[model samples]
Target: MLKALRCNSLERCFQRVTSLAEARQALAEPQTILWLDLFNPSQEELQDVGAAFHLHPLAVEDASHKHQRPKIEEYDSFYLLVFYTVQAEPSPERLRVCELSIFLGERYLITVHSEPIPELEETEQRWTRNVRQLEGGVIVLLYSLLDTIVDQYFPVLDAMVEQAEALEDRLFSGELRQRSFTQDLLALKKRFLTLRRIAGPERDVLNVLTNRDNPLFNEHALLYFRDVYDHIMRVADTVDLYRDQLSSTMDANLSIVSNDLNKTMRTLTAASIVLVVDALLAGIWGMNFEYMPELHWTYGYALALTVMAVISLLLLLIFRRLR
Candidate 1:
């Protein structure tokens, strides 16, 4: 679906266009700033928009294709930026990343994404309610979009932090089964890695927009971009910290499991020794000798049993002392 919002220079007029053709018509107003958003557009639709705007074919291709890394590229007429929108799924083991491509020009901004972005909807509503917000021009629009995308990282990070804490509690409390804990830890690690992959480069992208000289962004707009960049840095740092925590947690879990196994083995070994001693005495007595002297004694059977019991008790006490 294609959605368009246009505001005039005075910020007094605002309109929403439903089709790409109507958006193109709105763009004809030189003093108007337009934001065109494409949600899961078909290849042909993307190509048509590209052709209409005279966008670089490479940029169009990147937008059409999925899984482009977060980046910013400068073209003669516009700037192309790719970013990932991240959200943690209901399951702690899962994460969702959606790619968003932006083409920012002097008077217009276009965004393309394969998934519905709640931030985009919020931004659209803000502009719809008050057109004056768009008076800062396309740069302000770009900043809003970036800020929204960066803001989303916090919730995902928060979810990860909660999961990490829960896992730690379970690990120390001995509530988590070893096998399941390992699986969960590994899964959380993967989620953190995925978040890092998205946030790390996206931070660099924002840095370029903020620190580097880009004709598309004026000095006033650069400050806003810097704010977004700072947020991204925070997210990146949190991801790194979480990764370290996960590693440490995994190590602690392994140590606990190893200690438990050692205790189990020790108990088994002690039991085996006692059983072996009992079996040795039984084996000797079972060897029936025709002239055994003890066999003739009236108390011989009682004496043999008492001796076996005493030996077993002594061995158990010795093992316990050693332990």
Candidate 2:
């Protein structure tokens, strides 16, 4: 699906461009800036967008595929930027990553994504709310959009930390079994690693946008992008810190599981020893080929029963004290 919004400097308001022809018409206006968003575009739709905007074939191809790394590249007419949006999944996978490709031009901005991003809607809302104050350029819009995407990392990180802390608590609570405990830790660890992989490179993308000398960004826009850069840096740091925490959590869980297994083995060994004593006594008296003297005695049966009970009780006490 394709949606277009045009912001005109003279009108100081946002207008929706319903069709490609309308978008082209809006692009021709000197004081107007257009934002074209494509959600899961089909092959024909991509062709249309590429032809309409005169985008490079390589840029369109990159947008057509998924799993592009986060980076910025300069094309003939515009800049092709690949960025990742992440959310926490409820399944064992734990992390869901989506790629968003942005085409930034002087007069227009185009965004392509295979998955829906709430940040896009948030950026639109922010733009709508502050349309009158904005100077009707793509730079401010890009800043707002990038800032929203970077800010979203905070909540995702918070959720991951909360889950890690919960697992840590359960590790010592002695309530969780072995299998489920390990799976949860490993899943959480993977979540942190995913966040690190995306956020680290995204920080570099923002860094280039901020520090590089680009005529597209004015002083105000540079300030805005720098703010975004700062946010992504913090996100990168948080990801690294939590990744280390997850490693430690995994190690601690393994140690706890091993200790529990050893304790179980010790208990089983003690129980088996106690059972072996009774088996030994029964074996010696069960021979019937030659008559056993104790078996023929009057009180022999009671004496054997008494001896078994005494020995079992003594072994039980010893094992309990040792434990």
Candidate 3:
């Protein structure tokens, strides 16, 4: 899908351009700010756009591929930026990451992504409501897009924090078993690591945009990028803290499981000792020998039974006291 937003002197227009030819025509207009957004464009479409804008072949290739790390690369005529948009799945244990590639030029901006980003749609809505805000040229639009993407990280981080807290509560209350809770903690740990992998590099990307000298961004526009840099730093710090907390939680869970197992083994050992005493007495009495005089006595059977019962009771009392 291809969507375009054009802002001219008279009015602002937003439409979906169906063919590559239409997108090229929109870009041809003079003194207009055009935003072309392509969702999962084919190689042919990418090459056509690259040819039209004189974009470097290497940058076009990078845009066509996935799994690119977040960074900013400066070219002779434009800047190629890669950023990740994050979303938490219905299951809090997992996170979904989507790569958004942006080409920022003096008069035009192009965004390419395989997955749908709600942040882009929201930014378009904001642009429609007030076109004047984006009149500052492509830099303003670039800032708006980056700001929206950075803001999205907070809600995902918040959800993960809530999940960690809930798991901690269950751990202490003994509502979750060791095996089940350990699996959950492991899942949370993995998600946190994934988040850090994205956020850490992206923060550095923003830091470069803020500190480095780039002709694409003016003094006023650099300020906005710095603000975004601060937000990314906060997100990075929070992720680090959560990782430490998760490690501690896992260690505590393992300790609890070990302690429970030890108690069970102790109880089983005490029970086995009591049974062994009874078995020993039975073995002695059952031995058949003609020289055994007690076998002929009248009260011999009752006396033997009484003796066994007394010994068993005494052993039971001793075991209980030791426990």
TM-score of each: 0.93, 0.87, 0.88
lDDT of 2 by residue, 48-125 (tens): 899989998888999998888899999777999999887767674577778999999998989999888988999999
Output the number of the TM-score-best candidate: 1
Residue pairs clashing in model 3 are none
- Candidate 3's residue-wise lDDT over 1-323, tens digit each? 77777766345555555666676686677757778898999999899889988899999999999999998898989989999999988776678889999998878889999988899988777666666655567777888888989899999999889989988898899674657788888998899999999989999899888887767677888998999999999999999998999999888888888888888998888778767877787787778887875667888778877887898789888878987
lDDT of 1: 0.86
Query: lDDT at 123 for candidate 1?
Result: 70
lDDT string for model 1 (1-323, tens) is 88888888674677778888887888888888889999999999999999888899999999999989899998989999999888777776788788999999988999999888888987766656655556677887788788888898898899889989999999888574568889989998999999999988898898888887766677887888889988999999999998999999998988888888899999999999988988998888778789765667888778878888999999999999999
Clashing pairs in 2: none
Residue 47 error, candidate 2, Å:
2.0
In candidate 1, residue 263 scores what lDDT? 91
Candidate ranking under lDDT, highest first, comes to 2, 1, 3
Relative to the true structure, candidate 3 has a C-alpha RMSD (angstroms) of 2.7
**Candidate 3 structure lDDT:** 0.85
TM-score of 2: 0.87
Candidate 3 residue-wise lDDT at 249: 87
- Positional deviation of residue 110's Cα in model 2 after best superposition, in angstroms: 0.4
